[model samples]
Target: MPKSVWFLIIGMLVNTTGNSFLWPLNAIYMHDYLGKTLAMAGFVLMLNSAAGVLGNLLGGFLFDKIGGYKAIMLGIFLTVVSLIGLTQWHEWPHYVWLLTLLGFSGGIVFPSMFALAGTAWPEGGRKAFNAIYLAQNVGVAVGPALAGIVAEKGFDNVFEVNLWMYVLFFFIALLTFKRFETDSVVPKNVVSERKRITNKASLYALLIISSSSVLCWIAYSQWSATISSYTQDLGLSLKQYSLLWTINGLLIVAAQPLIAPLVKRWENNLKRQLVFGVVIIAISFGIVAFASDFKMFAAAMVVLTFGEMFYTPALPTIANQLAPKGRQGFYQGILNSATTVGRMIGPLFGGIMVDQFGMMALMSILVIIVVIAVIPCLVYDRPLVKRSKSTTVLE
Candidate 1:
């Protein structure tokens, strides 16, 4: 493996290990352990998600202006501080502020990571990125599975582990910073012709698709937010819930590497894959609404994982394909922002509908949103190709 790839993997592992507990249990801790209501928990997540969206946008701007390693190191430090706060503190107002900080800081890490990967191998950024993607899924799979096992001992145990995870990430990041500085890898201006294309029409169409795609993720994100509670209401244990997360992670690991060749085969036409992802996610969540048995829920998750496999890799691929030269980081940041949008709004949307009308109603609404998101793929088909020797940006 290349040194750069190792850097990405180690960074991802540390980041995700902290994220494992933070994401799955954050809301649960607020609502169940800390005595906040479900709506209140959703609201806190909403605030965090909103912060994340802004962070993605600003992080992109920072990456574009300042550079990669500096921005990412700052993000890692902030995240570490946030984790420490969450582990030690328990008050409502303080936790809310910490959650906001965590979301904001965590937001910076992703776009910077993607931008750095894109810059490091200007020629094969996407393929090299596939490795980073795989590493992330591995971390995702491990974090929740481990969290589940520890949560069986108690929620505090989970939080304690997360604190250590952040400490691990902090030191690893320090090492990563030194490694990047000493390494030969640096951003190269390989693209001789610099073009700047800002198609408002296309950008609008993309955001519409992005919003809808985000809604599907919102639907998927519910499995962690409310679905676990729903399963517990149905009498499942933490171990069983962990099994579900384990299945989701394994699917991502097994599926992501396979996605690279297919994406390559599809080349710049990754929008079609994005459409397929939305469709699959919609179907899975729709089924989950009716699931009464463990097997049925497992089947729904399998379908959901298929959608994830298609969508997660394709989002960045499409962004890169559409992005102007020298601005891939900005658009990738935008792509990260879309996920934050979905996460921020998803909890509120899912919580309300599920609280009022139940899971079926929530799933129905997500299906419509996803269908609406797919419409743009029909008309927005041009790949932002580099104009060999020209320096002008065009449609």
Candidate 2:
């Protein structure tokens, strides 16, 4: 890996660490602390995710036009300003407004980061993405543990800690990324010619894969949304819920070394890997449907973490691989947008389902959604493969 990639990973760690403090607590804070209902909390989260959708699109465009360094810095500045405001006015409508702003700003950072990682260490293949994913889990592992402790004192302290983490993140970006460039690994002319031949197939594959990505996120999001609330209904405390995330993060971080060799065995078979991961995720939700205690929830989380470990890194790598030259940022943006869309809808969808139906129905529906998502994953590569065969026959 290049020095730039290392710096990028470290920056991701700081970025996610800061975000972890707020995200896990968002629904709980809104419902329990702010005297809002679960549905209202879901609505606020939907607004936040909607802002992120815009940010993802805009940030990717900026990365392509201005380059990663400037785009990322711009995002960091917006997020920092939002965080500062949140620290002071974290009450009612003010909290909603500030969180939406924070979501938009934070959204801008991710597409640029993933685009940079793809460009920075193209030769590193999936390792580059895995490193970033690992860094993310490290933040997840550290942030929630500390956040639970801080929140026990006061929710205000949680906001304060998050604000400082972003402050550190801003400095790190300023110091390390000032000289970063967004040049393609392949030459521009070569990429242009290749695009003329491969554009249609690539676009089709991206769309299919992106559809699957959306479904995965919708189901995955329950952990932070309705599932969090459900645990409280079952007599769990905030700290206990935080510990679930902590366990998730630790498992992701700790299990990577053991899991890497197995993954390598299927390194070239990403489609199969995705299907397997998605199936595991579906099963995990099924487990959640039956969970009544913290131990059962922990078990479900562990299963969910394993599924994520397999799926998370591959999605971005696939997007990067299918991207055509200068459009890398654009394709990556689409991928982010898909996840954002799922997130935008997931909370409200889950909240309504749980409220109107019940937890059993919500979990069961998620399982079915994930299972249906597998069809696209299995077929997304067919177009590319057929195209390759025809080209071979012509030659």
Candidate 3:
């Protein structure tokens, strides 16, 4: 990998580390410490995710128009400011407002980071995305372990730790990415009409793929929202809950070496890989429905982590492949938006279901939704597959 790519990875590590401290605790803190109901906690999270959707779109546009450096810095600045305010005033409405702003700011950073990674190592293929994904898990691994300890002291300590991480992240970005430049303006007439049509077809496929991704995230996000609260209701400690995430992150990092070969083997069959992974994810949730102890929850998490490892890296790689020249950021932004949309809806939906119908009902419904998502995943690339077959015949 290039120096620039490594820098991006390091930046992601710090950035995600800061973020992981807060997000995994958001639902629990709101419900337990702040005296909010699970349903209300979910609503706050939904608002946060909605803000993220806007930020994803805006960041992508700015990355295309201004460049990654400026766009990322802008995001970091906003996020840091929000974090500072959160440290001081984390009461009810104030906490909600700061968290929403944090979501927007953080959202801007993610799409830009992914876009920069794609540009940094265009020839690196899945390796580029895998690196970023790995860095994220590394953050997850470190952040939650430390957060678990800090939360033992107080939730205020958790917020302070997160604030410092972002401050470090901002400095890293300032020093390392100041000269970063990847944006390019493609000439309108450079491509013939036929190639333009091809680009459009590719984009359509990407959108379909993105839709499937959204559904997958909706099911997956229950871990942080309803499932987190559900565990506490089952008499699990906060330390145990945090430990689950630590286990998830450690498993991803530890298993990546073994998983990479399989990923390469199926590199040409991303759709098949997605379907297989989604099945595992759906099954994991079914297992969760039966879980009555921390051990069973941990078992479900291990399965869910495997599924995530398989599919998560592929999403960005596919987006990078489908992106037209000068629009990598925009396409990545769309992909981020899809994931954010799922996240935005997931908490609220899960909260409502659990509140009204109960945990078993929510789990059953999620499994069904995930299974249905496989349809779009399987069919989204029909156009591209057809084009490939036709080209092969012509040859």
Highest-scoring model, lDDT: 3
Tens digit of per-residue lDDT, candidate 2, span 66-86: 788888999999999998999
How far residue 310's Cα lies from its native spot in candidate 2, in Å, is: 0.7
Worst 10 residues of 1 by lDDT: 382-391
Q: What does candidate 3's lDDT look like per residue over 185-277, in tens digits? A: 344557755566667778888899999888988888888899999999999988898899999999999998877787878989888788888
Q: Clashing residue pairs in candidate 1, if any?
A: none
Would you give me the overall lDDT of model 3? 0.89
- Model 2 steric clash pairs: none
Q: Estimate each model's TM-score.
A: 0.87, 0.95, 0.95
Query: Looking at model 1, how many pairs of residues clash?
Result: 0
Ordered list by lDDT, greatest first: 3, 2, 1
lDDT of each: 0.72, 0.88, 0.89
Candidate 2: list runs displaced more than 4 Å: 184-194, 389-395
Q: Is candidate 1 or candidate 2 better by lDDT?
A: 2
lDDT of 1 by residue, 1-395 (tens): 46765787778877776687658776667766788766677788889989988888877777776676777778888887887786787577888998898899989888877766766665775576666777777777788888878887877677678778877876776777445532222246553323223344335445655665576667767876777667767777767776787788788888656665776667666677777777887788778878887888889988988887877776666666555555665777888898898888877777777778887787777777766666655545432222322324321
In each prediction, how many residue pairs overlap at the backbone (N, C-alpha, C within less than 3 A)? Answer: 0, 0, 0
